[model samples]
Each structure stands twice: as structure tokens, then as C-alpha cells.
Target: MQQQPGLLFTLASFVAMIAVLVVVHEGGHYLAGRLFNTRIEAFGVGFGRELFGWTDKRCVRWRVNAIPLGGYVKFVGDMNEVSQIDPAIMALPERERRGLFAFLPLWQRAIIVAAGPLINFVFAILILAGFNLALGHPSSPPVVDKVVEGSAAAAAGLQPGDRILSVNGTSIARFEDIVTEVVTGVGKPVTLDIVRAGVPREVTVVPKMVETVDRFGNVTRHPQLGIVRPAEVIEDVGVADAFRLAVVDTGSIIATIGRTLRQVILGERSLAEMGGPVKTAQIAGQQASLGLVSAIAFMAFFSINLGFINLLPIPTLDGGHLLLYGIEAVRRQPLAEKVQQWAFMSGFAALMSLMAVLTWHDFGSVGLWARLSGLLG
Candidate 1:
């Protein structure tokens, strides 16, 4: 077996991953802002005190900050990195404020705000497409080789040789497709169209939540139907086809994320399963240890996740800005300054609270609390 990555290597991998993602995300905002001739004041990777930086010819301050958690692009006429409007900038004469972000047309502002998340999605798609072009697509026929006796598959009358046609009305061309569908539908009844003994039939199965423990004592729980498949087959894909498949795969991932979040909201999924920065770093390190390809794949997936999260309708996120812009478009006017401030403050608090909870969970997962107690005892 491959040796696990060391702590320092893990930390380095985590930082590298965050840094790359932040640069790409912030770069998106910077590019979009420049497109409309908006003046960018600063482009910094990470948050908090600046470690080192330099001003470019365009007068944009490029810097790397102390904290590696996230980054931002500070635009002219913005109060701070979050892009809040600066009253003084807004009050400037029209001609003097021409290139300021706050003075841009409403549509332009929306696009600039959205560019960050949109570019992340685009980048992920390109990475996946490249992988498909290089490695070809691997898949297996959606035929059940075996069904564990006590599994949901067997309970639903699934048998060896049954060919799955679709899951929950979505067509399934590969066994991997079935796995994706079933994994996300845990505890929920799934409708499957299948062919058994050359006869078309339908089956309903509810996947059981199963916990697996690895050799390192790490436990992971996922929903499973307990059906086995034959060896995977790799088929060469053309460039165009590779990109098309990549787009489809990206959409599927987004859908899965949405479904998982819905389950969490409905109390069907545990909060412990949700990972924060610490857990993410651990996973990043593990992926890095596997190989360059694995690490890159993780980056692509995480990029998609970063894009999706930022598009959420939370006040402090890109999505939140879009939400406000949407309301502005409908109202034909901007919201009052006090109201916007309150929204931003509330959103920041909500995000911080969520982060704290996830971080605590991360420490607990690694047995940090237990180790501390042991030391005290």
C-alpha cells in the first residue's frame, strides 16, 4: 500500500490547493472587472495582513496575505474587499467615478460579481475534459453481476443479469451512473427501470446507509444498494465528445450537491458528514499522496464546489450579491445603505458560525479533543 502523506506534506498540499483555487477565483473577478474598464485597486490571495505585495503598472496592488483561507479583488469605489460600496466613492463626480465598480451599469456589476463562480465552473469543465481526452472514459454496462443477499438490491428483487435501464426516470448507460444515483438517494425510494430475463420491469429500492472503516481507522458512511458489476471498460473519446461529457458530468455533480444539501436541511443527513477547511486539507493531502493526477482531479472537483457555494443565495457570497442585484432589477433602485449593511453583517455572522461548527467537527473527527483530554488527565 502507498504510504500515507506526512503532516507537513499534508499542510503544504492544503495550502497549495487553497492558494491555486483562490488565485483562479479572484482572477476571474479581476478579469471581469477589467473587461468593463473598472479600476481594480487590489488583487490579493488570502485574507488579513499583507505579507508582501507590489503595485502593477495599472496601479493594482498584488499581494499575498498571512491567512490562506480565501482571497479577494478590491475594486475602486468599494468600501472593502467584500465589495461594499464606499459612500465617498459613490459621492464622487460622475466623470471622476467613471471606471469605479459601484458606478458601473447594473447589468455590468452583476456580471462582474458572477464571473468568479462562473469561471470556477468553466475551469473545472476544462480540467475534466482534458482528463477524458487523455485517459478515455471508463464505464461498465449497467448489468447486475451479483446482489448481496441482505442488501436493498436483493430486497427489491434485483438478481444477477438484471440490466438497469434508468434510475428515478433518468437513463443510465453505465453501472457508475447507477451508483451515482443510488448514493444520493439514500433513505429515499428510487424507481429503477430494468430488463430481467429479456422482460422489461420496474423496481423500487431504498439504499441503506452503510459505514466503512479503512485500515487507518478512518470511517466513512455512504448509501449503498449492494450490487456488484463486471470490470470497467475504457472507451476512447474524441475531443468534442470529451468536452460534452465533461459538461454533463459537471452538471451531475452540481445536482448531487444540491440533493445532499437538501437532505441535510431535512435532517436525513448528519452535520458531521459535512467537512470544513481542516477536513478539506486532510483530503487534499491524501489526494496529493496518491499522485499528480489524483491531486488535479481533487482540485477540479473542489473548484466546482467553490463555484457552487459562492452562487448560493447567502448575503455575503457572490450569490448573495446576485440576489440583491436581482431585487434591484425588479425594484428599479438600489436598497437603502443601512439595509444592505445589516444584510452583509448578518450574512457574515451566519457564515462564521457555520465555519466554527465545521471546524469543531473537523477537530473532533481527528480525535483532537480526545487527545487533549488524555493529556490533561
Candidate 2:
């Protein structure tokens, strides 16, 4: 929180990044509400005390709040940022009630609730598309272009031009997957299935842990099989191809997230591997310092994650709103107001608990606990 240059720069970059994504998210809701004829009372750029604001011609208050974390769109007859229907709104005139969010058609409400995540996905697609258009599409087949002398590849009989088929029985299609599996399974024996000279063979090897120092002198460790690609091959793609590949990239990302979550659920990953806002900010800052392209890539990944996470049918989130709509559709009636309130409360508690755990993990990652222990010792 102090004004150290590095910390300050990091906080600024994090706030700026969050502000961009949050505005995009809230703007999605606001625009959808407008399209659906729902009266949006306030469009806030941030949460917390309002620093300044202006009322638009349509009587919609646009506010910039003190907090730079995120933002929301407050619709008419809403009790809070989560868009809970105000109890008093029920007694309003029918004309007024019709304009309020509480009285909107279920279909329209669903569209408005869903628009936030929908636009996030759209943003990611467009960002990825832009990246592909500006920078050529990344294309690297699972072919070994180079083999280090006396390294794992050489020791395991991996020859140049060998096309990798799989790793430990998991088939790999992209060159990136080879690095991912090796990194994830570091210090473990792996069986690399390869096709050499049109003949299939298997090679056993253990990836060597390599220490890499970034420009900022940050040392990170990862497993390397000593096989390398001389240079990444990039192909220029047209608009249609870019868009199609963008969708494919998004799908791959979602699948990867699913696999990671499954691994965690199956106890293959430790809870300490998880992270929250602090980690996000730290990484965001680091990415920003790297370059604009790196930062944009990071934001795209985060935006997709945000969209995916919000679609889960947990209460107090956009997904939870959709869940309520689903229930109403099934029961042919709205849930009781008290029941909805309790559900929201339960959701809030769950989210806070998750945040607490993630924050604890962040502190540990930063060596806060270790530093404290040293002092107390």
C-alpha cells in the first residue's frame, strides 16, 4: 500500500486493468437493459463512496466511485448492486413498475442478466481476433525441431524431426501441450510417444528442472525436456479465419480450466495452488510491465475466466440470477422473497469464504507468514 515505485506501478496497472474489464461488464448490462426497456437508475464505474457523477438526459446517473476494483449497473427498483428487487417497488404504480427491473419479462430479465458474461466472451473473442489479425496466428505442430546435445531428449533417443504423439498416454496435438504436461509432471518419469521415420516408438525420460530469470530478475523453475523449437511459425489469417480460431482458442481455454478444476477436485492439486485478487493484481502488474501485447493477452484470459465463472449457478452472482429464472420457469411462480434473500446471503458467505482462503494463499505466496514467523522467532 506504500508508495514504492514498483508497488505503486503495480497497483496502478491492476486498477486500470480491472477498471477496463469492469466497465465493459457493466456496460453490457446497461446496454442490454436499454435494449429491453428496463430503466437503469445508475451506472457506476466503481464501488464504494461516489467521487463524482452526472445525470444523463435519460435521468441515468453515471458515477465514478472511490474504489477502483470493479463496478456495477443499478437498475430502477433495485435494492442493491446485486439487483435484488426492492420490496417497496411492489407497491409502485403499474406504469412505473413496468419500467423497473423487478417487473421485466422473464426472458428479457434473463437476457439482461446474461449480457454481462456474454459480452465478456465477445470481448475475448474480439481481442483474440484482433491479436491474430495484427500478429499472425500461432502455429506450431508437435514436431521436434531441435534436440539439445547430452540432454533428456538425446538420452531418451529423441531425434530431430520426431513428431510427438503423446506424453504418458495423453495424446498431444500442439507443441505447447508437450511443455504443459512436462511442467505439470515435473520431477516425474514420462513416456513420450513419437513417430520417427514413419515408425512409432516410445522413449522414457525425466524432465530436468530449469531455473529461468526474467528481465526483472524473477527466478522461476520449470521442467524442460531439452527439445526446442528454433522459432515459432506464424501464419497470417484473414478475418473469418481469425474469428473461427478465436472461438477455438476460447473453447480450448475453457476446456483447460475445466481440467484444472477437475484435478483440484480430485485432490491432484493442492489448495495452495489457488489464488484470488491479490495474485490477480500482482500478475496484472507484471504483465503490464512486460508490454502492451502481454498485458492484453493476460486481460483476455482473465476476461474469459470472468465470463465463465459468472455463469456458474451460484447465488449472489449473475449465474445465480439465471438459476432463479430457471426455478421460476419450472415452478410457474417466483420464489418467496425471504427465500431469495436467504439464498443471496448464503451465496455471499460462500464467496467471502473463498476470498478469505485465496487471500491467505496470496499472503503465503508473498512470504508474509514466513516473514512474520521470522520476526516472532
Candidate 3:
């Protein structure tokens, strides 16, 4: 049995992941701003009280703060880390405003804001590409080696020696493809084209939702089809092929995320599956305990998620800024200050509420509430 990661280890892993991703994200914004000669007032890691910092030659204050949850980059003429405009900076002479972020051309500003998320995607792709180059590509044939008794696969008449050809009309190149389809189509009927004994046939299987408890007392639920695959095959690939595969993999993962979000919104998936900071830390810790390669892979996956999340068109996020810029581009004018402020406020509130709910769920998943109640009794 694998040893569970300790609390401290898990927390350290989580913090490290956040720190690296935050720097990469904010670094993208900072680099793009510099490319356009936009002045940066501060680049901070973490939030709240300052732990230590230094002023760069360009007068950018680089800071390490007390709270390690998140970080920010404050552009010139911004009132806060979220980059709200400072009216006082607007009053500065036009000459003084030349390098201010607010004064930059709309296109330049948009690029600066978008750089953060774009770089995250790039970062993930590079990581995956590197892995592929070093480890080669891994795949297993979509042949069923065994079918668990009383499982959905058994109910659907799937048997050993069956080869899956497609899932809902999507061609399955490998066993992983079948697993992905089943996982994503949890609790829904999945149509599979299969070949058995040199004969083609089809089956409809409804994956059952299953709950699991890890050694650390964390509960997780996911859908599963009780079919096992044979040994995997590893194929060597050139650098070009590796990179191409990485791009394809990254795009597929992004699309999967979009699909999952859509399912959640459409009530096809459970909100409880969504994880917050606590759950993320737990997962980070588990990955770290597995080994360096596992940890790095998790980091890459999280990087893609981070980038995708920021691109959401919620106010106060990078996507929100881009949305406003898009509107300004269409209207040839910025929205009213009041309107922008209200939107940001609403976004902030919505985010906080979501965080609260997810955190609660995370705590419950770990039996924290149960423990507390037991202690009280």
C-alpha cells in the first residue's frame, strides 16, 4: 500500500504549485506590459501583509506577502491589484501618463491582459511536450481483458476479448479513449461499437457512479466501467511528433474541461465534484507523494486549469478585462466607470460565495465536520 502524504507535505506541495503558477501567470503580464513600454508599479506573490520585497531599477516593487493563496501584478495608474483605474493617475499630465497601463492603446492593453492566460496554456503544452520527448507516447489497445461481475460492462453484455471501436460515434484509438468517454459520460448511456470474435456489434452501457475513500480519509466519487485493459504499449516519437502530440493532448484536455463545465451548468453533473483550495491541496499532496514526475504532471494539468479559469468572462478576472476591452473595441469607448465597478463587485461576490461553498464541500469530503461533531458530542 502507498503511504499517505502528511498534512505538512500536502500543504507545502500546494503552496509550491500555487507559487510557480502565479509567477508564471504574473510574469506573462509583466513581460507583455514591458514589451509595450507600460510601467508596472508592483509585482507581488501572495496577498495581504508584506513579508519582504525590493524595488527594481524600473521602480517596480517586487513583493512576497503573508498570504500564499494568490498573487497579483499592479500596473501603473491602477488603484488595486485587480487593475482598477485610479482617477488621480488620469489627472496626471498626458506626458506623465504615457507609460501608464490605462493610457496604452486598446490593443496593447488587451494583449497585456491576455498574456497571463495565454502563457499558462503555453506552459502546460511545453511541460507535456517535454514529457513526451523524454518518455515517449504510451497507449494500450482498446481490448477488454476482463469484465467485473455485476458491473455496467457486464450488464451491457461486454465480455473479455471484446475490442471497442468507438464511443458515441467517436473513434477510439486506445483504451484510454474509452476510459475518457466513460468518465465524462458518467451516469449517462454510452453507445459503444465493439468487435468480438471477428463480428461487429454495439452496446449501450450506463457507467455507475462509485464512491471511494483514500487512506487519508478523503472521499471521492467518479464514474467507472468495470473493464480492464491489457499491458500498455510505448512508442518512440521524434521531437516534432512529441510536440504535435502535446498540442493535441492540450487541446483535448481543454475541450474536456469545457464539456465538464457545461455538464455542471446543465445539471448533468454534481456540484460536489467541484473542488476548492483545500481539496486541491489534498490532491497536490497526493501527487507529490507519488514522485517527482507525478508532481510535475499534476502541476502541468493545474496550469491548464488555472489558465482556463482566468479566461472565464467573470468580472475582476483576466477574462473580464478582456471582455470589457472587447466591448470598448466594438463601441469605440470604455464602459462607464460605475458600470465597471459594479460588475467587478458582483464578480468578486460571486467568486467569494463559490469559494465558500467549495471549501465547505472539501471539509466535508475529509470528514472534518463529522470529526468536529463527534468531538462536540
TM-score against truth, every candidate = 0.97, 0.86, 0.94
lDDT of 2 by residue, 128-174 (tens): 99999999898788999989997877888888899999988988878
Q: Give the per-residue lDDT of model 1 (tens digit) for 322-356.
A: 99999999999999999999999999999999999
Model 3 scores worst on lDDT over the 10 consecutive residues at 212-221
| lDDT values, one for every candidate | 0.91, 0.85, 0.91
Clashing pairs in 3: none
lDDT of 3 by residue, 171-215 (tens): 988998887777776577888899999999989988889887766
How many Å off is the CA of 75 in candidate 1?
Answer: 0.3
RMSD of 2: 3.6
Which segments of candidate 1 are over 4 A away from where they belong? 1-3, 214-217
| RMSD vs true structure, all candidates | 1.4, 3.6, 1.9
Model 2, runs deviating above 4 Å: 1-5, 146-159, 165-173, 180-194, 200-226
Clashes of 2: 0
